[model samples]
Target: MTEAAAQRAGRDAEAAPSLLYLVKRTEQAVRARLDEVLKPAGVTALQYTALTVLERHDGLTAAQLARDSFVTAQSMADMVRTLEARGHVVRSPNPVNRRELLIALTELGHRLLDDYRRPVRELEHRMTGGLSAPEVDQLRAALDSAWRQLN
Candidate 1:
């Protein structure tokens, strides 16, 4: 290679990946691990996320659940249908807002969440195995701050 091209190549080799790239890769890895852990229970990582949100805050609108689950409204609509069909969630008309329906976890959903809680915790522990607790907290805070800024 020409000297200029060689210098450019060296710089490129020493450069770290962008934060966006690293974050995407980390998300993919987490999703894959969650899928592996949840597959036996017949739930996707996304579905599990929605269920967990409901476990914490019951009777949220579909849009609210979608936002909490980090999915699009349309995607949440379909997910709600599938989850409802599978007896994981149910939708009922909002008592205060008759036109809007609220989604809530079913008994089966609670049971499934309970069943996978330990495995999910183990997955998180494994993912943060090398990081100290403070580092993990820092990572979480950084990510949350980035997300808030982007939003």
Candidate 2:
């Protein structure tokens, strides 16, 4: 084969989708889309995820937030520090365990989350616009299973 033909053949072979490739690509696209939409509001996707978790389950320790947010403890600490500095989160001594610090969303944090709700929902709608509700559920289940298998 000519060099051009050889390169085309290689590209064709790599284009055959695998679950891993598809998942990674989807994650990248989703993150990019979220970042673009959230930039004006001043939060990255990871920061938004941390905020969302805290909103749902308040008063979690830094370590717990790290696990829930799928981030390293060090990164979570940094994120928490940044959020606290921005007045979006507050850290207090865990009453039950004085050694650990429990983090909670401040009123500002709640306000920020509330502000993003509509945009985030619209983004989700756009993402799943092609899929039926059942398919969306199945996709969620399959992804959850895959995550459980790996972790």
Candidate 3:
């Protein structure tokens, strides 16, 4: 490479701000904190996300849950197995689709979800703690718009 191009590349790496990098870094911090909170209960960050999906959309298939959380079906299936073994979820034949299985949170899962509710809310509060409600709302809307545009 030419000297000028090499210097420009070095400068870009040193000073450029990447939106993708910022988003991933913030997500990693939040995930680390959440994992710290959930680990005591034998829950992983990925499992917690699966549980959150079940809470929002009960009776979702493992495939559906995977899609909801940006995971592969195989990974979600493994998580569902772990959750099932822990008595936090149950899997059954999909009522309408004979070939597919449906996954749902058990009563134990519901109770566990209720039990750990505070930490998740606390995490969100911490994430937006410095912002006023209006600012938070605006940020949310902007994020929603951007996500829709990109995705």
Candidate 4:
């Protein structure tokens, strides 16, 4: 290769940020902040996410919850078990499908979510504290587009 081409390649390799690295780093940072914020409530970030999903759409099966929460079915099963033991959620046999178990948030779960709403919202606001509203929207759009690209 020519000297000019070799230099350019080295510069490109050193200067360009990996998209995967950036995404993973951002996720880690967010999760760390969420863990700190949610610790007092005795909920991990994944558990909180699952609870939020259940709050939005009650009566989801464990497998469905796993899909929605981006976790493995086994992890979801364990989480469901924990939630059930804590009385935050209950599972019942699906009437339409006896083989499937439908999971629903109990009244305690609803109340717990209500308690978490403000703190989590504040944490989100803090995460985007530097961004204007428009910038936040743009960031969301860009991230969503990137996510869609993977599919």
Compared with the true structure, all predictions reach lDDT values of 0.95, 0.93, 0.89, 0.92
Among these predicted structures, which one has the highest TM-score?
A: 4
> Any residue pairs clashing in model 3, and if so which?
none
Off by over 4 Å in 1: 1-14
lDDT of 3 at 90: 95
Best by lDDT: 1
Off by over 4 Å in 2: 1-15
Worst 10 residues of 1 by lDDT: 13-22
Cα lDDT tens digits for candidate 3, 1-151: 9999999999989787787788889889988999988887889888988898999999998888999977998998888899999999998998799889899999988887887899888988999999999999998998889789988
lDDT of 3 at 38: 86
| TM-score leaderboard ranking | 4, 1, 3, 2
Which ranges in model 4 have alpha carbons more than 4 Å from their true place? 1-14
List model 1 lDDT by residue over 1-151, tens digit each: 9999999998997796988899999999999999999999888999999999999999999999999999999999999999999999999999999999999999999999999999999999999999999999998899899998999
Clashes of each: 0, 0, 0, 0
lDDT of 3 at 45: 82
> By the lDDT metric, which is better: model 2 or model 3?
2
> Residue 57, candidate 1: how far off, in angstroms?
1.5
